[model samples]
Target: MTDEPQRAGRRTRLYALTDGRTAAPHTVLTMDTTITAAVDAHDGLPSEWRAVLAMCPAPNGRAVAEIAARMRMRLTPMALLLGELADRGLIHHRPPLEGAETTNVHLLMRIRDNLARI
Candidate 1:
């Protein structure tokens, strides 16, 4: 039988690899963010994170969803791992592009006006 720490370590490793599907399916990873070589060299980095960094092409990096899918990990854990990497300055988490979140209020108003004109 394995010791408690060993069992916990195994669990972590398993969690790091498998997608338990507990997180929101729509959880979006910042597509524009880039992980760096520093992350690759960081000895303290978790294997799951390191795997993500390795999979990332750098400069262009990848979407959070893409990275999570590639890594076969859950969305929340992937986000947390990316946050950890950013905290360590081993990666850059670029916020979603401005104006990308424009609401449809303008469209709705235009539609309402057009309907009134009918």
Candidate 2:
């Protein structure tokens, strides 16, 4: 069997390629005498996703399937939601794993982990 630490390193790298989306941005409505927010704003993301998103330590990006699994749905549904967000300028959909920033974050996480073990 491979070393546990090395296997963990590979697992970390695998997950690195999955992150690509950003967190949903919250728009600030005017703080007037009366402020009305959507049910979602007060309620937060659908229960399923709220927990899953919370579990994401890095708090950015997701593989299509990752979101779907959280919602207990299929990839098609997640794709639709992501598309809708992008269309509404609420979120951006990245091309697969093209973002350099995600890679940097992933690398940083790996370094942090390795350092912690030393």
Candidate 3:
């Protein structure tokens, strides 16, 4: 009555998907980083990479955490894949806003309340 088997399988799959790379190279992406597709075509790419590209269209973008959730992937592996795509000019991202830690909590609460009322 444990999920260990499933967890192991998922871990193995992620390892393969990332080609055993534990970290992204030359790129620093945070959970809130906004990702967007930079290329129109995804021919000859791996299915996971294609999935990532498909999830990210142009203009409006998705947050790294959102993409990881939608794709059922861990943040680190997703970031690694995204970093590779960015290196190849297949995608681009905007890091989380600087100084977000100092943002006004009251304003955020108001926004949350407004959203709840909608």
**lDDT comparison, 1 vs 3, better candidate:** 3
Candidates sorted on TM-score, descending? 3, 1, 2
lDDT of 3 at 4: 13
| lDDT, candidate 3, at 109 | 89
State the displacement of the C-alpha of residue 93, model 3, in Å, after optimal TM-score superposition: 0.7
> lDDT: which candidate is best?
3
Please give the CA lDDT of all the candidate structures: 0.52, 0.37, 0.71
Query: So what's the TM-score on candidate 3?
Result: 0.66
Clashing pairs in 3: none
Q: Write the per-residue lDDT of candidate 1 for residues 22-118, one digit (tens) a residue.
A: 3333333454443444445344755655566665645655556556656556766777666655655566555553564436678558646743543
Between candidates 2 and 3, which one is better according to lDDT? 3
Better of 1 and 2 by lDDT: 1
Candidate 2, which ten residues in sequence have the lowest lDDT sum?
29-38
Q: How high a TM-score does candidate 2 get?
A: 0.36
Q: Which stretches of candidate 2 lie over 4 Å from their true place?
A: 1-59, 98-118
lDDT (tens digit, per residue) of candidate 2 on 29-110: 1111111111221133443323333323232444455455444555654554444344444443344433574578876696
Q: Per-residue CA lDDT of candidate 3, range 1-118, in tens?
A: 3211122232336657566766667788888898998876456766667777776788867778777777677888778878877877788998765687539798568646743543
